[model samples]
Target: MTTAFITHHDCGLHNMGPEHPESPIRLLAIQKVLQKTGLIEQLKQMESVHVTPEQIQLAHANLHQKRLEMKQPDEGVVYADEDTALCPDSLHAASLAAGSSILATNQVLSDKVDNAFCAVRPPGHHAEHNAAMGFCFYNNVAIGAMHALQQPNVNRVAVVDFDVHHCNGTVDIFKDKPEVLVCSTFQHPYYPERYCDIQRDNIVNCPIEAHTRASVFREQLEKYWLPAIQNHKPDIIFISAGFDAHHEDPMADLNLTEEDYRWATQLLMDAARTTCGGRIVSVLEGGYNPVSLAFSVQAHLEVMAGY
Candidate 1:
């Protein structure tokens, strides 16, 4: 199996503050770990390209990109929402973040790579179709899924999010579109609580309580997500891979170790082997603690790299 690692140096430029959990150090940590373990040399590393405005509109409102451009501060950071902020280089990095997903989709669909992992900042699962929040802007995975749907021989797609928080933005964009199947396992009564309870055949939401154990998380996915993916029979699979659910993470309460991440990645990989010919494009979402996040990502990539 061949895996592609897609990232951009500029993704580190969108710094909110030194105290902010979503600092550039997150990417630096992942890179450092990958290099230390010799995993970086095993994958096809590529720089991310900028996404066009037309592609950004695939999952966003027509004015969404323009509004963000308009709000960009010249000299200092400006808050788009209570949690999301924008500095001079924020949009530039965001454009690359969104673009990395598009490039990964293309690489996977073209059979150039069996799967791809996008390491990007300003994670996008919380960014709604009309708003940006939760340290996210421009719903990156959504843009990639939309792009994949437009490609030849691609009839349907599935998005699996294992983040501690629900993928409100991804659900918001594809809730009405039956061709896209979204399955998520998140902590109940969490942040950005929108579309969490909306009933849709395409959206399968498994809301686990805080402090949920890894075994229970696996059980929930096997019961809720596995069946959905089998029924959907997607042409491609996209993962909103978030490591914030790790037990060591300061962001949320979940007792998942790197081994759990490895187990989940293998579960999805097994599903992909049968359903989509092992085509998966995973985008980075929320993982705050640099040490735990790096190790967790290493586990996920190890499986993708055929270890």
Candidate 2:
């Protein structure tokens, strides 16, 4: 149950817009839930560092990196796409968001903690290696997975995503890299729809139709993700922990509850314990409904904390 809690205030400063579903309140809600549930006191809290450009290059192209920097607005917000934008401190916040993953990875792999949950923002998993969209600037989990691969005794790593939208960015980065396995479950015919059907051996995509319930989500994980992860035998596990699929969330049409998230975390913990020494780095991706997001995160972290 030794888990590190990594986050930063800058993550909250990456404001897209007041009406944006991926607002800073998402992080605030998660924090409130942790505090209210007394889970904050039970774990080690660490400030997230800024991710280096070189580390970011592991998953994103140099041009894309520089473009984000160049797009940083000095005053008002500037749009990366219709859905994503950069305010005055957006790049800094995004950097911290990406860095949270790196910090969590090092902590878990070094055994400083058995696992980590990074409650940061600017949800990644949608931004491609050369593009920034879907309220994502950098592929945070992908960068962390590449960082883990650089460490000695760390080769195979797995990135598991349960966001309502497909993690096209993560799969794009690791599709050809056999050492990194990307397993994602998302609602199909959804946002950033490309790459859901990409032909790759290392990428396992379980596209759940809209209105699917928790039972189906669980079944897919057991049938598709379990066998793939077991075969990959990852040295560490990274999760793009997005809860936008909740029935209460407006972002997608999946009928998952907080308990479903808890069950998924339990399954991953069991798999990690048997295969990767319980090394897991979970980075926040998407969850719009503040109340449900908070409760969902609470349930997820309880399992990560071995409660």
Candidate 3:
């Protein structure tokens, strides 16, 4: 399927603290597992380029980049919100994270790759249009979707987020834009609870309760998300792929295993093949437990890589 694996070493430089769950070790673990399983050799690996300020503005406020720049710490970490933090290299890594999505979109749309997986982080689903929170800075998937809308022959796009937390930032940016379909399955009454209840034809929000089982999650997606995607008929599909919903994850309560992730990826792949020529640009969001996260990502990639 020619799956592109996009990432940057500098993404590991944006460390908040050793105790922080969103540590660089997350990517390291994924890489180790991919290598150990010989799966890394099956994909097209590429380094991420930096996102331009103008491209960052595609889904952010004009002053957003400047404000983050002003707040960048010289040495110690600075808190952007109660949970999100910025170190000296945080923005640098964030720019790459956002940039990787852009590159992935380009690769998929150009037919150079059937799909791409962005493994960069300071995950962006909770970043919002103007504010940064939930360990996210710039909304990576949003920027990529916006970029795709500007491309030739790309009339519409769908963003499907399966994160434990709602994609408030992605919904915030595309809520009013009908051409962009935003679908999400998240735990109800969760963190950064904004735009979850906002009624929009383009947004299909399936808010599952905490401790939701795997079968139920799949049932919800089949009932809610499938109809929306079929109706939207997007030119491309973007996944805010978060594995934090895994049962072993310390972040949230959901009984999803790596097999669930594989099943979900396969479902999305089928949808993309039907509606978008199998063009998907998936960006990493939240997945805290290194072991579980790595295995989950492996399953997702295996499906995308046609393994």
Candidate 1: which stretches are off by over 4 Å?
A: none
Q: How displaced is residue 126 in candidate 1, in Å?
A: 0.8
What's the distance in Å from true for residue 15, model 3? Answer: 0.6
Model 2: residues >4 Å from true position, as ranges? none
Candidate 3, which segments miss by more than 4 Å at Cα? Answer: none
lDDT of each: 0.95, 0.92, 0.95
Clashing pairs in 1: none
TM-score of each: 0.99, 0.99, 0.99
Greater TM-score among 1 and 2 belongs to 1
Error of 3 at 34 (Å): 0.2
Model 2 TM-score on a 0 to 1 scale: 0.99
Measured over all alpha carbons after superposition, the RMSD of each candidate to the real structure, in angstroms, is 0.6, 0.8, 0.6
User: How displaced is residue 112 in candidate 2, in Å?
Assistant: 0.5
Worst 10 residues of 2 by lDDT: 13-22
- For model 2, what is the error of residue 191's alpha carbon versus the real structure, in angstroms, after optimal superposition? 1.0
lDDT of 1 by residue, 2-113 (tens): 9999999999999998888999999999999999999999999999999999999999999999999999999789999988999999999999999999999999999999
